[model samples]
Target chain A: MKPLTTGIAGIALLAVLVLAPLGLPPFAMTLLTEAVILGLFAMSLDLMFGYTRLVSFGHAAAYGLGAYACGWLLLNTGMPMLFAVFAGALLTGIVGLGVGWMCTLATGVSFSMLTLAFAQLLYAISFKWTSVTGGSDGLAGIPRTVGPFGFAALSSKAGFYYFALACLVGGFLACRALVRSPFGAVLRGIRENEAKTTALGYNTRLYKIAVVAVAYGLGGLAGGLYAPFAGFANTELLFWLLSGQVLIMVIVGGAGTLVGPILGAAFFMLMEHQLSAWTEAWALYFGLIFIAFVLFAPEGIWGLATGLATGRFRPASERH
Target chain B: MSTLALLLTQTVNALSQSALLFFLGVGLTLIFGLMRIVNFAHGALYMLGAFVGYSIAAWSGSFWLALAGAPLLVGLFGAGFELTILRRLYRRDAHAFLMVTFGLALVVGEAVRLTWGSDALQVAGPPALSGVVFMLDEPFPVYRLFLVAIGVVVAVAIWQFLERARLGLLIRATSQNADMANALGVDVKMIRSCVFGIGCGLAALGGVLAAPLVTASNGMAATVIIDAFVIVIIGGMGSFLGSLIGALLIGFVQVFGNYYAPDFALAFMYLVMLAVLVMRPGGLLGKEA
Candidate 1:
């Protein structure tokens, strides 16, 4: 019954987001598109980060790789849009496998560093591989292709916005199903106690790899879609900074909870829009807000909302 | 080029680069080791040190004042971070900490831009360290030699401090085994705060020293920190000796990589890190692996 309510709520939220671009200005719609794409990317990061206790600062490497792959395929092979996106996901999966393999050797800080190193490598490659990547200028003019239903000219902001929103919805539903499955239970077990999980005869490494691969694939899909909308793919997307942005979104929304990242992505993008408009030192303000959230809302926005509604906001010590 | 001169020049260049690398890597490694925080803002602190030095040099017309004073001021700023923010964040997950520090980096970087404007600042070396020295019939920059000397001195001082000082002992103990250190009655919290300050101070010094070497821009910290991460990874995290050796190795890679293939230098660093992780996850001298 609870899950059903949550599902209905989620659908309602999606409807609101879909309709938001229409009422708002064009600039707001553009921002909405960016938020949805980033929200999807953040959700992918949270899948591994929140569920498996594996935090990757290089997740953007996969996302950026996906963008590059899609753009590259579109220009070079002129493959179908869906097929190009599929190719991007495949490439991103391969890279994720390589990164995840190295990462499994170390836990905590070492894992983060390894992922970062791998991502930075991608950034460098993108920067230098001018012949293929268009170098620093990035691969621009990625032709808009027909969706499965046929060509509808998605090069416009409105078409891309709907496409992005649909992708976010589809991806979110898939992730929710994956989390509810037995595989996800095993992952949560591993996250709680790796030693105990391993003792239970579960191949923890395989699970970790599987989770990371899925996250990478999804992130890649988001990135690939993003490129054509932005009409470019730059090395900037592969940076640790982008990874940091995603982490903040996940944290601000809530980890381990499904709807948190979507809310987080919206909050962050909107906050940035408002803050940047008010002052150039918006980052400083954002940092302060982030610190406040980390200190006060350890459970995050969704957690806090639920806690308040349930009358569980009182201190545990005071409960006695 | 004469073999003697070329080798001498390369060695000097390596040491200079190593000094900059050590400044960036050691603080990063130490902070990570002690606080269990990645301190993504460490590079920004380094850049802040350089900008401070630049302003001081510009104002007082004394390179000496800038070199000596900027790091101290920056160190104080780092201490402020430990006392106010990082103290509460110590027990959080690495991802949260990373996000917080990353935000801090963004804020600091923007502040730098606001203060210094969007242009690069020109900072020169002291008169005494500005010229070149004849080495094997070739001239090598004296400033580079000074950098080498400073690197060696700082490295040695850190080595002795960690090995000999009571505070250092406490920090090493806390980092190696926090539970055991707590059992032994050491104030783990105090040690971590001090360690964070010292490490950030060292990064600040590195920035001040590097002001003349690289373009002093607000975004300089981002590039420096990334390179620092590569160096720290290669040297093995949490080991002082590992950081020094890693810096030297990376410096050599960068120099030679630039000569051989300029575009590959950054890629080359990542390749080294990947190779190291695959071959030795614990780093070159890391005891953990």
Candidate 2:
């Protein structure tokens, strides 16, 4: 898409999101809030998978850690909400740095598997350490606080929705800036040809670890928003299944495009909500759709839309 | 029992667990070796096998029939899936295979839940093997010993088959150099399908054996797939013997870790994997990256 058109679309999307809560019912508002949070989560995965070509099957480890940290802080310390979110993101960023360092040592499927193993370790801890993490029941009764002004009682559906929307927009802009920067160019270079990047005198490993940490920190920020929105953090968030879900969103929306995952997340969340309402066997249908998407439209919905708009279909090789 | 006896019993328990894991890991490695596709649905196939085994045993009152029937059925399904779906994907990005197989896992898991319901189903070991035997002043379940024996025999058989048999030679040749094997008139496509079927069969066989112990349930697929992947990763992705050794290592760690520190048993397993990854990124038997 051209820069002008992209800018217009961004403004239009922002307008819709800003006005959504005023017109929409409380239930739809809640769904939109969750969708935005999940969209940010999917965007973080895209930074690593789409841009860096690092398929992290354990991305949820950082995300869940963020949620758990935020939840624990709110429940135990009674800290201000913004402080809890910052603390959660900081803690997750540190953990991400450590884990991403080990993970960058390998590449390809082995790297994916290693990330998965680390996530599972974290999941095990959360599930077993009942005293601190609330075990399988998860940490509950988290209060929702918004902004530096210390606005409590943002637990109302519309209030939380707007807060989440603000965070999502902020996150999207930050991610867009990061991806368009020179560092993102290096990441793209590494993705296209890591060996070539290394031969070009670039330290690809250091770049990969740095990008991973940044992606994970963003994931943590999303998770921080998630804890207050949901009022609890569960171990399921750390499971590989959640990682797979985000991956599906990235692939189904459009991997390389920044806006694609958000579209994908919104599509998936809405479809899931609608499907489950229609049938209990929603996963079966969802699986079929996922398989069809991978087979037929590997570039995803965003790719399809762009192809239609531009009168040309770019193959996966030529995509961003 | 003395502490020594308890430790011995746990060691025996670990052996049986390792045997079960070997069944899943070896098959996974074989498929990956030949096809270069990580079969995420292998766990779902295992779950299907357990469900099939449960039904067969429940209806016919014959544990032996279920043991033979389940793997055979799932193996055929695996071959069909390869012919229908995976055959078209070989030319695409490797990530496509992972996504499709993961989708298959979701479909299969959901299908299992729909068919069997969400409740766990129990299937007893065969009557003859249900008894207990004293070992090291501890009464160990005879079925577990039988599982260990089966594991050893199967490991030896697999080794012998891969080393000595003509078809096995064809499989090895194809995996080693598919283009060369094709140039030499070997039907590489047929070999790929066959290997995939065998791999799925091996996973199913593990499920059938494990059903009596772990019970047949939808949750089994999730846990077993991760463990199977860990074994394959630690053993070397495509190395058969590496899978066996990796399984044994994981099995011992899990059993001993559970005994000593239940809270950290799973974490300990992952720690070992990380250590191996740091020391040998390709795994113990994996080729250098």
TM-score of chain B of each: 0.95, 0.98
Worst 10 residues of 2 chain A by lDDT: A145-154
* Clashes (candidate 2): 0
Per-residue alpha-carbon lDDT of candidate 1 for residues B116-196, written as tens digits (9 for 90 to 100) = 888988898898888888887787788889999999899999999999998888888999899899998998877776888
Measured with C-alpha atoms, the lDDT of residue B159 in candidate 2 is 94
DockQ by candidate, in order: 0.55, 0.73
> In model 2, which regions exceed 4 Å deviation?
A146-149, A152-155
DockQ of 1: 0.55
* Runs with alpha carbons beyond 4 Å of true place in candidate 1: A1-5, A147-150, A153-156, A313-320
Q: How accurate is candidate 1 locally (lDDT)?
A: 0.83
TM-score of each: 0.95, 0.97
Candidate 2, residue B177: the lDDT equals: 90
